[model samples]
Target: MNTQDAGPLLEIRRLTTRFQTQNGALNAADDVSLMVGKAETVGVVGESGCGKSVTSLSVLRLVPSPGKIEAGSILFDGEDLLSKTSRQMEGIRGKDISMIFQEPMTSLNPVYTVGKQVAEALLVHNPALGRKRARDQAIEMFGHVGISEPKSRFDTYPHQLSGGLRQRAMIAMALICRPKLLIADEPTTALDVTIEAQILRLMKKLQNETGTSILLISHNLSVIAETCDRVYVMYSGRIVEESDVFDLFDRTLHPYTSGLLASIPRKNSAIEPGKPLHSIPGGVPDMTRLPCGCKFAPRCEEVMEICCREEPTLADAGGGHCVRCWKFLGRKAVKV
Candidate 1:
């Protein structure tokens, strides 16, 4: 269903998350806004340390010490998460919303068997579930995620499983409760191409089966292209551009989004032997002390005088395609 016809499953409006650093307070997520429709797979794409992970963590109120949600609201199914108590969050975390963290090896417990780890959510959320029932359900989930010999693998530790298997175990754990929304933070970062494709396909299939909305966070544009229905392009902790998947590729706006799209390597496209691949110029700004204007002004090729003087807000260009750029704000490009 289209977004207009049905309300969003998760709506984050101007959510700002800050961290207390040596330099001072850093805005890890600055007035970030996005939404995930029912059963929709939305993606957040950007370079490393661009607040993709922080945005997801803030939704679940999982931001660690030294970091705080400074402003705005996170609305999930019409309820404001920021208003919920920590004890109330425990009931919502695994049952209604779940997260598949970046690294399975580190996210999974080495001390516990995979079965115990996977079943923990079920046992915690549903106290009526007995140990044997939880174990059986966990094994079933392992099979669903394509683990070999699911029964035997249930007893295995995270170290005992292969990289792909460990990832599958993590997926099983995340999906065990059949959550309404799944926030996957670079779920396929460490896997091989073949395994990555398989995992993506499996996630899509499960999403179809369970009608679970997904908020996928990754730096890989290709991965986002392969799965997401809509995309948000983030840079320096703020959303720069957002559009449907096809519009993003076909009619990309914002210099930063264009730069990201241009950097993707195309196997079929001819490449000159000595020519270097295109990369976005300059580096991400310091979060503790970001520039007064656009965060990407230093790297933006089509940057104008206004870009360095006045920060642009996300304005709709048409068809729900929004961009945060001075060019979209009717300013003429002035090359320095």
Candidate 2:
């Protein structure tokens, strides 16, 4: 389904999350805006410290201590999440929206059995289900998420499970309540290739079955390409480009996006023997002391004097593709 034609399930506008560090206030997410259509899988891709995780945390109003959402709105199902009271948010989270955090080992409680944790999620939103029913449902979900011998595995502690099973348990916890939206932050991090592929496929299958919209955050472009319908390319603390998966790869406009694509190792393609893989020069700038103009200007190979002098707004460059770059400033929007 075309996201433009369908109403958005979640819409974030001008979100700015700030952290008060000893050095200065840092904008972890700056004017970040994106949308997830119903049942659509959207991806946020960028290197570490680029604010991808912070943006997701902001949406759930779970930004860590000393970090606050200074501005912007997060609209979910036409309701402003930012305006909701903590009590109201408690009602919304897990039932309406759930997140599978980056690391299962860290996110999952070591003290609790994986089954009990997943069951608790259901119990939180549906107390009437009772412990017996909740346990049954959690086990069913574990089976659905591909856990072998769900009944036995459900009783195991997070430390007892392998990384893949821990991840599956996390997914079961997030999906048990059948939330409308699932925010998966680096869900496959540290998994083997086979496990990663399995996890991605399991998510896709579950999403299809439940019709849940997913906002998948990852630095892996290959993962994004395999799963997401649309892509949002984040930089220092801002979205540098937004496009459908096909166009983002086929007609990459932003220099940073191009650099990222170039960095990916291509299989079955001719390559010079012993050639070094392409890498974007320079690390993400310190948020507190970002460059005066474009955050990426210092590393951008096609940087212009104007690029270094003025920050560019995210402007449409046709076919629903938006880019924040000096080069595409005056280009007329063209429908594909």
Candidate 3:
């Protein structure tokens, strides 16, 4: 095992997952690869239904039974997670790699008290721990995640807490055992701005303190830019672009990445106030019936003849950047 001292904490290589739907087989994620180094944070950002959530779920082999990982591997600490059995994965989930879902209200057990729920997580991984010791550990972890009066909050039910507190509770539950890596899928979606900032800061601090790698998935481009060191932009089911945070925003190679950055609101823009937000100009093509060539070509502003004819491979484009587009191919001099 590579562990946290050296190399990547979690390495996902050419991971693909598809569902055999009634309509046809739907490709949720196709040949996606990325790395999360020890104590590093990598954000995966894309529009909804762009396979952001599915990629993270695939990391833990959590994708539904109907869907299958047809290719690639999830290498966690140099151990291929995809090769692990169900019982083996269960042991790893809370102990080595924990995940925090989007909605706390729905994700947290409604019937169990907050403390009891987190305590259960501790107990699950450590069968030797009795209920009282588990309860103490849960309270300590909850406090570590910034919950106020952890003792009192522990006994309260999930429904009794505010949305922000509930999210904190989720983080506490996920981090109770100090897992080596954490996957947060839009963890701040339901919280207000202040709470969002607090949670982000808290997670960052914990990452620094504990050296936990993070795989953060969100549609919020701004959050991705701020929190992540490297980013992977997904379109349709494939990774269309990957670059460092600054390169992504300053010198984006892919047209899809450019559009996403340009779509962010500006304080003093030249365009009229009523102008519509610049969407990609088309719905994401159905995965089951994706276009033959570059999946994003249908919505691309700089469409080319080759785009519809062949799927472009993710190729090195320069200075630590990779992009999949026919535009990168130098055109032959036209007979003018």
Candidate 4:
């Protein structure tokens, strides 16, 4: 498939998700906009609490209680999903688009057998299939995910499986129906490096075979670099920079993105003894009480006076790269 010629499979425009807090309504997702082209892989990279996972959940209209999609549109195949009814979304969710949630233990049912969960996903989307066929297909999926003795594992409960096996089962459940889009939230988290590589490779291979677009959410820049075509750097619930993966690594424009890239430990690179690993100073801003101006201004090394008084909008910085910093917005950064 020619990705260049294909239109976007999913487009999110000005999406804002909010949660009710004791203090007030906290904007978990603040006017976030992004797209995933057909047969393309887009990565949403950020530290914890940046709303990467919330953005994914909001796409599926599955935001947890106390939180709701307060504004904006989620366009899937050019249709607005925000306008869809819950019943309609039910048909959309595991059929047209599927999600592999962050954790398998919490996402998968403890009482049901692993095979049953996989079979249920298939059955929900393709309800005409018989139980026997669903069972057989579940076994097949388990095998495809590299689970040993698929037939035996099919009857085992979630607690009986190891973390890697459980995660594999979650992947199997997510992909069994071959949806057009896959929203994978931290798919390889908590796994060993070897298993993490295997899972990423499996997702890539499956995407190639099925021509499915992927929205990969991760905090690991290295994973995003390896698996994504385009990348969006999110900070404090807003996109700070977006570009092609190679361009993002080569010429990252946002200070937050630069800090994140600097923190990555380089392999085979000479390091001075007694020096500590690089870390971005400060912490993620509290969503309930975010700053009035640039949310990252407090911690940014290149912070300017205007950054503390004005919020910057994401603007194109040539060659499809967009940045939301004053330095890229035709304003010179002043020394603090």
Candidate 5:
């Protein structure tokens, strides 16, 4: 894919997802939009309950019961995914877009072998394929994901594999059909450091080989920095900031983005014991009763009166960067 000519494989526009709760239906993902260009990686980062997971589920139209995509469009290959029927979605699910979930232990079935699980993915997409061919392809996918002696492993059950191997199996299963877009939601949360690095590298390798675009959802800034070409910072169901990875971390325009970077300790930071610890302060606002001004205003140290009176709009700051903040609304930051 040429850098300049690449078009978005998946484009989310003004997508809003609401879930029914005890209080009322709340926007788990509110008017969030971003693009994943061909062979590109887009990272969605934020704390837990900040709509990171909800956004991905909405894109895949897999929102849990009691949740609905209230408005907006999800375009894949220039078609509206939100309007598709369940049968229509089935055709696109694995053949065009696939997802690797957070935990393989819970995501995988205990009753089936690792090979059977991966083979099932293929069988679901291509029913014409016989079980024998599906089994062979499953073994082949295991090798593609770096499992040694894939044929032997094919007969092994998920319980027999280690945590890293199970994750590998999950990745293999997800990519068996070589889908155009891959949505990986915290795919490495359960692995150890070494295995996590391996899985990341494996995904990168396969992506380059197959020209697959990826949407990686994670809380680890370092992981996002290493893999994603672009990123979105979400807060209280809204995308607060978005830009190229280098510009995002180096010259963040939103206060929430700045606080996220500040929370991560540098290698040379001086360590002091219990010196009033550092954090953004305040819990995630109640979804049903979010502040009228800014979702993050209650926790922002630099909050001003205007920040509490009006909601900020995502506007162009410069160089394809977008931020929602009163300070930068309708004008670029006059940097000195």
Candidate 6:
């Protein structure tokens, strides 16, 4: 796909995914909308349980049982994915859209050789390749992803490889088919800092080689800043801010975004010695009993009466940077 194309490769519109629990239905992803242009890396970032992972799962129609996509349209290559049947979606998953789940140790089948698992992915999508050819391709992919001694590693089981190698094998499986889009959900979560850096670099390198759009889900703002071309800041199952990566760091609008940036430790900062790091005051709200109006109002430092009474829409502030906060909406902040 040409990067210059104006249309996005994956466009999600007004997505609302809900999960049925004993209490009631809770919105895991509420009215979410985002896009990934061809060859562009878009990030969905927030703390855990903020619905970043649910949003990605919705894109692949893999929200898990009991969680239903109540309303939304996921358009991939100008085709609506929600409208496709299960069999059709299966065909598209590995061949058109692939995912690297958060934990490789849990995601990879424990009983099978890591190489065989990767090879199985290719064969599932293209069975005509035959086992021998699939194994050959899988080994080639292992080498491509920087795994040492691909031939020797082919017969090694998942438990035998280190965390980094397991992750690389997962990546190779996801990219073996060269899908149009890759959904990486916390791809580097369990690795050391050095391995994390290598994985991030490898993804970028592979993107350049394959021209695959990536929808990267991560809780770490630093990772998003390094890997994403554009970013969507999610909170309480909804997107509060969307902007170019550079603009997001330079001119943050939402208070939540501000809080998140403040929490990142700065290397060159002149803070007093032994000063503790800054952290957001409160935890994520309970989804089933979310606070009325602005879901983030209770935690927002600049909370207004209007924010507590009415939810703010995601509106453009200026220059295509969108924010969902009363402070940026030109509304007067009445004291509580």
Local error of candidate 5 at 159, Å?
1.5
| Residue-level lDDT tens digits of model 1 in 1-336 | 112445899999999999998899888999999999999999999999999999999999999888999999998887889999999998998889999976897669999999899998789998799988998999999999999899988888999988888999999988999998999999999999999999999999999999999999999999999999999999988999999999999888899998888888889878778888889998888888788788899888987787888899888889989999888766433432
How many collisions per candidate?
A: 0, 0, 0, 0, 0, 0
Report, for every candidate in turn, its global Cα lDDT versus the true structure: 0.90, 0.91, 0.87, 0.90, 0.88, 0.91
Q: Looking at candidate 3, what is the lDDT of residue 260?
A: 88
Instruction: Give per-residue lDDT, candidate 2, residue 41.
Output: 100
Q: What residue pairs clash in candidate 2, if any at all?
A: none
What would the TM-scores of all predictions be? 0.95, 0.95, 0.94, 0.94, 0.93, 0.95
User: Lowest-scoring 10 consecutive residues by lDDT in candidate 4?
Assistant: 327-336
* Candidate 1 lDDT for residue 9: 91
The C-alpha RMSD of each candidate to the native structure, in angstroms, is 3.1, 3.1, 2.5, 3.0, 2.9, 2.7
Worst 10 residues of 5 by lDDT: 1-10
lDDT of 5: 0.88
Backbone clash total for model 3 is 0
Model 5 over residues 11-120: C-alpha lDDT tens digits? Answer: 89998999888997789999988899989999999888989998999887989988898999998887889888999998888778999977897668978899998999
Error of 1 at 262 (Å): 0.8
Please, what's the RMSD in Å of model 2? 3.1
Q: lDDT score, residue 329, model 2? A: 80
Candidates 1 and 3 compared by TM-score, better number: 1
Error of 2 at 292 (Å): 1.5
What's model 4's TM-score?
0.94
Q: Distance (Å) between predicted and true CA of 225, model 4?
A: 0.9
